[model samples]
Target: MSKYHSFNSEKNIKYKLPNEITLFWNKGLFDSFIGIDKVNIHYAQFIQEQVECPTIVIVPGRCESYLKYQELSFDLYQQGYNIFIIDHRGQGLSGRMLLNVNKGYVTKFQDYVDDLRYFIENIVTPKSSEKPYLLAHSMGGTIATRFMQDSPNAIKAAVISSPMLGFYSGLLPKSIAKILVAIKLKFNNIISNTPWYFLGQKDYSPVNFTDNKLTHSIPRYQYFVDLYKKNKIIQLGGVTTHWLAQSIAAQKELFSKIVQLKTPILLLQASGDTVVCQQAQDDFCQQLHTLQPQSCPNGVPSNIDNAFHELFFETDDLRNKAITQSLAWFEQHT
Candidate 1:
């Protein structure tokens, strides 16, 4: 089992939602507990009818927490699926600075798998008597893909939104990048580039989610902004050298073996995404075709256009299309 940390601080952290935003009213609670190395895993639950409906566990992207997904949960609830979401170990209100390094850096990709296993066995399964499905976005999609590789039987199905099979940045020679990260990890264990510059823009305030917004409006975004302002520890910059080394290693392993995974999967690619390379998605689907020919009988890829990386949160029309296609796929397989 991985080590978990306990946060005993009593700081009065408050979240202020924008006045223009309307509250999502439902019977729910903000909960946390130590899991997978005692990291404070934070989550929220919305319970409605007690029928044995399917449970959908949503894993968010990097720098995102469960609170940031409240709007998505509301939609799932309306679809009659019980909803549960987690703030991955390094992100959200989970444990901070697990090592002597900044938050959001994990030495091994399997650390996330372990954390998700703990969450599934301890939280999602016990809470409601229902089969579980997974929906992951961005970095969350990477984590979900890794999890499916190891434990294909764990979930009924998985929907990956703009999965980060690879980043959009032009490739570096893998050998050179690995050497640099290995050298840095030996000394510091954690390294970060400057915070993604777009995160700090005034016009791009995290809390500004009107109907035309790129993402959902969550009070926690403003809270995190303030948290980053004061503490500076919560800001997740680009991947570290150690992170890069481990991630590249993991991606290689996943791509080489993903064809063996029998777990049903729905890969939702975003045509307008500028973060992950389209070639990676193409390569992954092709590999699946070679290995699991029955899975892609049409010999064609499934894709959606006119959307950015966060397809589910793109413009209203695109977002609806993503949701419609995803839920339709899930329904077909479930």
Candidate 2:
């Protein structure tokens, strides 16, 4: 384990390191030998105190870097849990899939799921003695649910933070969006590649803290902004039509399979969230509640009053509350 006494404590970053820790990142090429294509994937791990602890794998939201999660991981570590996080393809420090790194693009959603499975099977499962727990945020939550649907035994329990079970499609209805996407997919055949943006989406222009809907804590929010500013690899622009279509399809499929999920899961609903549909979360949790309550293979839902999409980056009180609630949920099913 890479031992660390502090996380640049002298510099006064958001949170100070509290334990002997190891931090390392894996920079690997996508070799067909492993069947991961040519895409490069970035992964980071944090081991705390050399203690016998259960592993917790975090899948961050779209356009997010694992570096944005350092404080949360530190808090989890203080509670005696090991950490592993992945920066998905086409985003973060991972290799970009398109000529325009700022534009989000993916051939299909299954590729993302496969990549996560590869990471778990090869990187996490062998190193840790305990079955890892999953904690997914936004798009990560969508991918995590899909992963659980296919491989339920991979993780002991999971906590989804404001998962994208449903999207805030805004003025566009589902029928219209699907029809538009179908048209774009058809256009793909005529053109080499379709470059249609999602409605009025644009490139990565830094949103001032006041206009941002992500988090309430300006300081914590700015901390990540600085990280993105330092590295263009961690920055992503507007969503493409293909990504929007894939997100809709993935969430639709995952919700359909909600009744069959045997994994113990908790859906953390953000009461003040505008990014994803809270009604969709309630719908899935309602179905999960039908199977079991406070038990394995059950989908439990909790609302964090006055919270936003980025619960982990919220105000200190709210952030700590989320971290505390998550630890409690993980322990319940562990």
Candidate 3:
């Protein structure tokens, strides 16, 4: 094990941007995923005083950018881990796919994995520690799981928070929604590329706190809302039909290869999460245990009872518990 100097939480609890925490960005990532597009991805890192530190790469969810993960990055930095956060293509300050920048769009699910791989291979892996962990949430978790299945050695461990292994389709059944989407993809010329929005979905509209399912803390929730209200460049709205179909298919591919993954992946399931399907998580973790009994004796998913969909974005107490458990799980695997 590497000599990781743990942070003194009591002393370092007051969130200060210490000199050790430095930020950097990378641009002009040329991606050949769809017709040789040059997609720019921005990334930031927090360095500590140590010569070699354990690293954690933060992959933000749908409609999210690295800007929102500043607090989480700082907290992780205080915990003796260097942080690397990236805003994937189409989100954040990266190039948008369509005229309506708010529309969540992707050529295919693999396009995301390709872009992530580009960031890792060209940017992160070169400067990061020998062993790095992935901390991904929601849609980000879905992407990460696919990445792990394809490239198992990319990270030492992964904390998949409220993973979109299968998304909650509100009033509609999952199978029915998927079938409708599949049919819509055929006749629509721009369906797979630049397409119409999902039903009842549109450009960015701020959701009121009363209807919010993210966090229990008002200040934190408002902080994110205010962020989007201020920086429209990072404000991504509802999903497009192309994105939904790709997400559904990618999730199917991920679970198919879940048992083959060698890296330690912890499915951080939230008991109160209404955004994702908990039953899917249960099924995936159970299969992992059955296939790899040695590595996953009791399965890797950990249920945080009081937590919501956004574990890191939740109340301070909930966030702290999730982070503590996540860090411990990573360390044990390391």
Q: What are the models' TM-scores?
A: 0.76, 0.87, 0.87
Q: Candidate 1 lDDT (Cα, whole model)? A: 0.64
Error of 2 at 119 (Å): 0.8
Q: Give the clashing residue pairs of candidate 3, or none.
A: none
Q: Candidate 1 lDDT, tens digit per residue, 64-89? A: 76755654576677677788888777
lDDT of model 1 at position 252: 78
Question: How should the candidates be ordered by lDDT, best one leading?
Answer: 2, 3, 1
As for model 1, its CA RMSD to the true structure in angstroms is 9.1
Q: What count of clashes does model 1 give?
A: 7
Q: Give one digit per residue, the lDDT tens place, for model 3 in 1-334.
A: 1243343232232333234432322221222222217666667666667978888888888888887776677668767877877777788877787899999998788888877777677667877767688999998988887888788778888888898988877789988988888877664655344588877789989999889988886777777788788898998889887788888889889887876688777778889989889888888888877776633338757888888899887776677778887887887876
- The local distance difference test score of each candidate is 0.64, 0.77, 0.76
Taking all chains together, the TM-score of candidate 3 against the true structure is 0.87
Per-residue alpha-carbon lDDT of candidate 2 for residues 1-334, written as tens digits (9 for 90 to 100): 1232222231244433223322322221212213257788888776655857898999999999886777777667666878888888878878777788888878788788888998888888887888999999999998888998889778898999999988875788867767887787667546756556666778887899999888888777777888788776689998888888888889888877865577788788889899998878888887777864643234446888888899888886677667777787787877
Per-residue lDDT for 201 in model 3? 81
Question: What C-alpha lDDT, on a 0 to 100 scale, does residue 334 get in candidate 1?
Answer: 74
- The TM-score of candidate 2 is 0.87
